[model samples]
Target: MPHPASAAPTSRFPAWLLICGSLMAIAPLSIDMYLPSFPTLAGDLGVDIGQVQLTLGAFLVGLALGQAFYGPFSDRFGRKPPLYVGLCLYVLAAMGCALARNVESLMLWRFLQALGGCAGMVMARAVIRDRLEAHESARAFSSLMLVMGVAPILAPIIGGAVLTVSGWRAIFWVLSGAGLLILLLVHLRMEESLDRRHAAPLRLGTVARSYAELLRDREFLGYSLSAGFGSAGMFAYISGSPFVLIELHGIAPSHYGFVFGANALGLITMSQLNARLVRGRSLDQVLGATLLAALAAGMVLAVAALAGMAVLPVLLGGFFVFIGALGCVSPNASALALAHQGHRAGTASALMGTLQFSLGTLGGAAVSVWRDGSALPLGVVMAACGAGAVLMRHYGRSGARARPGAR
Candidate 1:
């Protein structure tokens, strides 16, 4: 209908949307795709399930550290180069993961893979900031969520199928292939989203100042922490779900996949709903309402667990509502935070992601340490994160109102 060359920005929107969504999908794929392989991987590597699970922690650690590194680098160089390098590293690390001889080696390779994969996560947000105003960016993020959401929904199914026929090693090989294909798409279709004039030089002092500026902005920290703490509950759910569903409730692995997909669908549905709601509403107002909703859901969850009423059905309903709240919180927070940080979008995006992953790691670790083969620990951690988000949002808004000549 439109000339292809002129269509790059809008008319051929689906092409770029797919690319950006794929970029965001990289981290989720890396995390969820190998989950079904945990048992087989432990057996093959001569380690127990707990040891195999450490690879997840290692990957998350890498994701936190690597996002911090690439955000500044992307700000200095153009977005495209950092992404290219990160994807290349991802491919290499995935190959190493496939060839690993032991749990320790696999952990190292997984960390490297995460380090590389996080570039996509950070840059995807930055690219959205680069192209759109705050409100538009929120909608773009929800659309991206729709595309990226499919990865978590399908990755386990795909991984389970591969593990069924070709074994766990084949799973790594498949990830490697996916990385290579994404790299090719980037080279062929994606243009530089960051304008050269806005590029800051990569110096230690400059980088420190950039981050320092972000930390000093009260609104930015509020939105970032609100989003981070809101999303942390889902990470706790992910870390605890396998045990709760499969081991405790005795759901079969095949059926667990379906249950997992169902919860993820809740998340996806809420995110798109957020996109629609925001069209006629302010991001701040929508965020406030969603944070409160998530808090209520978390309260119900914790009360159920504390009272020993955490049957599988109850737990599933709580997860559906809680994660759906995050779908609203995340896009709004990112858009609001970056609204004022347009000049330093990469650094802001990076810091936001770093906080999110760090908080998630804390929630996940709490489940491991406090796990008593009951749902209490998971429920408590989830509730805490939600409460923290609500408090942050309240403080942020109050502080904004107190500022002289504030909008």
Candidate 2:
């Protein structure tokens, strides 16, 4: 195995793949690992499900705000120190989460936890940019997704077992330990990908200007939104699936993890294959294929739902294919969008990820509101987001033409 550090920068990759994967996995690990524990939390904290769910929104808000700072700080200072500080904070906040006596306290701690976690999550992409060229970045990102993908596949099972054996608090103990381990790996072995070439005193003003520029630029927004909405499509499925399956189709809550893992498997499978698909095609061409495929798959699901095809296997199987296309669409579209934002990659990545997650949270919320023990609402939501992705792509090319500098 090539070392993630000290690997020669050839077109061929070395072991930095592990670093990329580990970094990207941080948030998914945090989220997925805690999901199965939500019920326990609600019961223990003497709160309703909605109260417990707010913890998710709290964490998401912190992630967005913290990402805004992390990218600029990393650009200004260096990659390693910010992460070290952030991870330390993460451990503390996670411990706080474990100890909280009420819903309000848990929400506050979860927010802090996300703030700290965003350091690793955002910078992972920046570090990837630091080490690789554009095409290489896309490939490396896909490889990283492969690493992060394991969280959804395994977190629930582990959380379930922990819940059965110990209690919800045990979940935080696991997280705290994981954070400590990551902290060690990073300090002992992870080298600073932020090089001397970065402009001195990477000022907040400069970062602000970068965000300003990205906002004014339509191509960046369009491509970014395509990826963002594609993510929202998956979120729609996630929020609606449990109800649609459990209440409507009678799947057990205990088996929800397996159902969830099946979808993630589709995502992982597609992401792993993305590099091969793009080998000879232009990035846009590959992205177009993925988007069209998503649109097509979603149309199938919509039809199935409208036609009273209420079978659980078919509903999930269709979404399995749909989310798989999304896995391909999201990374490739994001890679293409950020291709030229070298000086402001952190800001760009933060903006993209923030909007992606925000849209995700919104889509999930929509499912909860519109839910009625049927698959139609979820199918409609997925189809709507899929269509939005297509429109975003349509606008992205035009925007690219208008803004000559958008890379």
**Leading candidate by lDDT:** 1
Worst 10 residues of 2 by lDDT: 1-10
Residue-by-residue lDDT tens digits, candidate 2, 103-200: 89988999999889888877787777666666766777777777888988887677777777889888888988888988888877777776656544
* Model 1, residue 149: C-alpha shift (Å): 0.4
lDDT by residue (tens digit), candidate 1, 1-407: 11211122363246766789999999889888888787788899999776777788788888888899989898888778889999999999999999999999999999999999999999889888877788888888888888898988898778888888999999899999999999999899887777777778899999999888777777888888888888678778877777787778887665666777887788899889998999899888999999988888888889998898999889889888898888888889888878777788788889988988888777777776677888888888988999999888876676566656877
Which candidate leads in TM-score? Answer: 1
Model 1 weakest lDDT span, ten residues long = 1-10
- RMSD to native, candidate 1: 3.1
